[model samples]
Target: MKYSELHGNIDRGFNVFLLILVSSIVFLLLNIFFYKFQDNISYFE
Candidate 1:
């Protein structure tokens, strides 16, 4: 029972880590795309 509890805790920690990693990556990608779009609009103007 103790071992299962430890495993569950580890799983939860791993999931949280993965969620943070994925969100940061997506945020970075969106920022890059937004900057590129802004530059294109400014260039056209």
Candidate 2:
């Protein structure tokens, strides 16, 4: 019983870590895209 509980905790922690990693990656991609879009707009102006 104790082992299972510990395993469950670890699983939850891993899931949380994965979520944070994915969100950060997505945020980075969005920032890069926004900067590129702004550059294009300025180039046309």
For model 2, residues 1-45, the per-residue Cα lDDT tens digits are 999999999999999999999999999999999999999999999
- How many collisions per candidate? 0, 0
* lDDT at 42, model 2: 100
Off by more than 4 A, model 1: none
Give the Cα error of residue 6 in candidate 2, in Å: 0.4
Clashes of 2: 0
Clashing pairs in 1: none
| Candidate 1 least-lDDT 10 residues | 1-10
lDDT of 1: 1.00
Report per-prediction Cα RMSD to one decimal. Answer: 0.3, 0.3
Q: Give lDDT tens digits, candidate 1, residues 4-36.
A: 999999999999999999999999999999999
